[model samples]
Target: MDCCSPSRRQALLWAGVAAAPLAFAAAEPGAAAAAMPKDALLVTDAEVVTVTDSSVVITWFTGSATQTDRYGAPAPVPADTELLLGEPGNPGSTRTVYHDTAPTAFHHAEVHGLDPGRTYAFTARSAGQDAQQSTLQFPGTGGSSDAPGVFTTLQPPPGRYLFTLALSNDLHMGEQTAGIITGNWPPAFQQDPGLPPYPEVMLEALLDDLRKPDRGAEVLLVAGDLTSEAKPGDVARVRQLLDGWGTLGTDYFVARGNHDRPHVGADYAACTPIPYATDHHDCWGDVFPYPRQTLSVHQVGGLRIVGLDTTTLDAAGGTLDDGQLADLAAELRRDKDRPTLLFGHHPVTYESAVTTAAGPAFDLDQTKARQLEALYHRTPGVFLHHSGHTHRNKRTFMEESQSVEFLEVAATKEYPGGCSLVRVFTGGYQVNFYKTRADLARQWSQRTRGEYYGIWPHYTLGTIADRNHTVVRDLSGLTALRPR
Candidate 1:
């Protein structure tokens, strides 16, 4: 079936329902449920992903069927809300499977002929109750003469603009080992006590910080390794973590990383090297599928953000395949004039001796790196490539191009409780690394006699400022970097 066809759309709706067993239970009437008041409310996890003068996709979810009707002038309400499937806008009513569930009780509806740079306050209703109401701002253009509704609209400032995004990686949800996991056998794996399962903890803290009014970051891009061992339970845990943060307005995107694949064997290292196993492949597909890529020609003011899935090879380390690379090239070609930022799990290039010592090793495919570099050179917008793996704080500038910056992020687990906060402004981009609030860093430092290699000690500062012009910043006060 055509994936974009109407039938395929129906299938997507059913898939949502099949995955949510708890939603089904909540929908059922119970003795206790009868006592609770029933008011029509929109059951939605709605958030704004991308916004422009002409279009927007406000993604949301619902417990049951809903209706999108106009209440006041600019706001919408439920006219005749009920649990109905496949009725006009209600594509979710016909399917019994969980996937059939819709993000909202309804899907995308175009608010056509909208005035530029206007703010519209819209609400959703389910079971004849108001579910959610939020205002969306549209950037206006110069030539528009018509105004549709009495809403406030603002246009983006003229000339080039910069958008800021947050980068995080190697969450490793259920993984037991901080370093490599080597032991007698599978049963021996039971003996290994993991260093710290703090990925979730740090993620929550980092998110909380970002949600602050002053953070100014509107987009979040996770480079990959969201879970350890690609187990369904682990994937579910990661989902719960993200779902908890759904309220934040940051638009989130993710790419598949090495550890995100299912457990193949003790030797199975990167998700890109081997074909996925039977049960495990589905889990990965269901949780962290590849091509989670997003491209914004005008992300953040005028800059473009290109998110790539570099770990598409197999279970082992590999770069993007030829077809994916071609697609990437096409995308770059489309927006060659805009400054572009690349986000992915693997680095296009690196020169780290310490990471080389690790078993599966660090470094992107040399041939692929050169290919991508050539593409970047041809494309004017490509300025920075952000990656995370080999959990360490490091930055490398390609001498060949001098135009591209390769930034490696520290893992969220291990010693210095890894978290990086990135801010973009009209001047330039600033990245501040914060040590996790947990005392694990100090404890590890004391126990290892300064030999703690798991977490680097130099990122303890509450903030770090990066001037747009300088590639190197004085991190002296931020965190002391130990000599390699």
Candidate 2:
């Protein structure tokens, strides 16, 4: 299937760019400018990552690192990250905050305790000194900045509790390799004999965490890639693990992933693919509730939870057949007032700090992505779109077409292993990430940092502070369903 037109995507999407550089003049050898080390504090790529009514995360790179990939890749030099933040000109109210010490050239920090809908000025103090005037300011931007780079806080989510859910994805059960796709090979990735395989150990740990009482999640959702392959044994193991949490379809929900797609093989001759659905593989739709249960819905409080079978019938990429799309449209059209939570295995829009060929292919085809977007906007109650193919934690809000937050979560079977707890309230909702406390799970997360190559810490645990922040949304349209 064809991806969306480049012109369409470009016209619809908005993103932040690296901070503009400042012009400098030649100075005498004895001048402070000449005296500063060439490697002295320099901040680049500083832009907003996450924003809410009370908190904002500004991430940037320092020194001279030739960082390529967005995740796992660290900055080149060690610099102390600091933020001088306050309302435009209130020097007395300004606070100086610093980031933790890591060898990474990247610096990210979230500042809390601000009023909603207010403009604030922020600048970086990286390396050993405050940012010099090498940053250019945008023209006519609101809020004043000494060096340029400021943001306005957004309205927080509603202030009442309605429901909660747990989400995890891409466990990749029955896999023998660790970090092979990590661009660079690390020795520790080779699972030493006698260890009860990384996937098993990590998954067990994940299950233990999500079941904790404090989580209080009424529903558990596995976004996709339930197994490394759609083999019978792997499928059975995943079902068994899920049953440990609760009865499937009642307490938890799942979607099929590309890795879980049926493949041509002679393991057994009795299995045949279903029409318009399961033609390529011998597993999945036959053994599990896919395609057959492709369009399933569950209700919690006043919300409608919808799951989509985005897995392709023949390719590794994802797509929704005419039947699936039509069903989704009918469901949304049935009740426009009920808020919805949609989960799937593929992302609607590719989210990446750096562009790569894999971005588009890694997500649902562009044409389908747009179709889903239009559907969501037309329905309006679809507030949250959860997906898990990229194996990273990033949240994006669609402001123009409609107000929906799209979250991409990390793999539960590797580094940054864990799940997200979504707390919904009468006022709004908050989605927070938890690094599963399972000892083996924690160990595996660190061990697999090599999987992300050297960029692991930069994207996983080290970035946890920003990854675990809150989201406050507008829920006025969602009237609670009283006892009927």
Candidate 3:
């Protein structure tokens, strides 16, 4: 259970802090003095939320120069927003521009007619002012080359798109605050007084976006952490909201996370109790019970989707009991060639663990993690492992399971709030992260962007490639679950 030394985690955390603040003024000479003019509308946190072969959604925040929020950060201000895009390095190229004349603080623009597999240079402007000194440059580009911005469109998926699967996690329902990371110096973010809970706003936004025909997600996989603390009311409320979205067992599925594990308390006395911890009541279990067993498989057309419960009753780190591991191995052996997507709460790669301050607790225990990795190594059918605990967007590949991508997504209730759409095709598949675009969702996301010294984006907004990309595999085996 003691997977990694705390000394190593502390060392890595310090190293990350030292190297990550390069975006701050203290790390960059003249950055503080070169701050935007007080009167000029400031545009910052511009990022490509979702990128397909033909389109991409760009979102950013425009702050009011004359006003501030209760947190003492610049408040959102109305401004004209536009997207300037063209072929990378080709100023003379016929530029394509999309304008949202609505004059709002949280800007969301969708650009279409982009050529497949081509790289484009682009930037978002507000009131004709650019974020020239933005600490968080657009997702991909950085340094002097940020001008005109840069991102490569995903190459088309290998074949016809068979179905779309929405991937998201860490809703953290019932949590009253956001960005509560370590000490008091870095304050947490909270909803303004009297406002609906921020988590509710975000969850509704995510469901609305997924419901749109444009997104066309036939199934949804919420990796884990459905509740903030496994509170009974919160657990039931989460289920009620999700049931409004889709049927739990067929249309959508969820896994357990550390936060959703049962705790011993009087409030949960009426809830189901776990055998592993008999004194603890399982509120999460009572609301959304596992279908057949803790580890179960569902077939979508020809693709095999395995939902694994990785949370442990006793600790924050995750593990698979001997029985569950044996069940997974047997299921994989049932159809060795079937394309499989396994999702759980905790990440299963060593690299994902060290990157966060939580270290071992941020991931599955090394013993079970390696066990899962080795199982995937022998199972060519397993192509992806989706998880959400680190609350960041990171794509990792391990030598033992080179074919399976270990993906960690950011929380859906905070900055960069959104989900990824997995487009499964005959030849391969693509994963595109889409930040929720609803009005309140975008506004709340912008507010939370100020978390962690305004360097939050530096850590959470991963590279453009990490958010969107295509992979070629022999998925000819997968048939359409629903028509596109």
Tens digits of lDDT, candidate 2, 204-278: 887776666655676788898888867777888888888887777777898888777666555523466655544
Per-candidate TM-scores read: 0.52, 0.65, 0.89
What ordering of candidates by TM-score runs from best to worst? 3, 2, 1
Compute the lDDT for candidate 1: 0.45
Q: Model 1: residues >4 Å from true position, as ranges?
A: 1-163, 184-196, 213-216, 247-250, 262-280, 289-301, 312-316, 350-355, 359-361, 438-484
Winner on lDDT between 1 and 2 is: 2
lDDT of 3 at 237: 88
lDDT of 3: 0.77
**Per-residue alpha-carbon lDDT of model 3 for 155-261, expressed as tens digits?**
88777779999989999899887765434434668887888898889999999989888788989999988888889889988999999998987889899887888
Q: State the displacement of the C-alpha of residue 73, model 2, in Å, after optimal TM-score superposition.
A: 16
Alpha carbon lDDT of residue 147, candidate 1? 22
Highest TM-score among the candidates is held by which one? Answer: 3
Clashing pairs in 3: 122-148
Task: Give the poorly placed runs of model 2, Cα more than 4 Å off.
Answer: 1-158, 182-188, 268-272, 276-279, 350-357, 457-466, 474-484
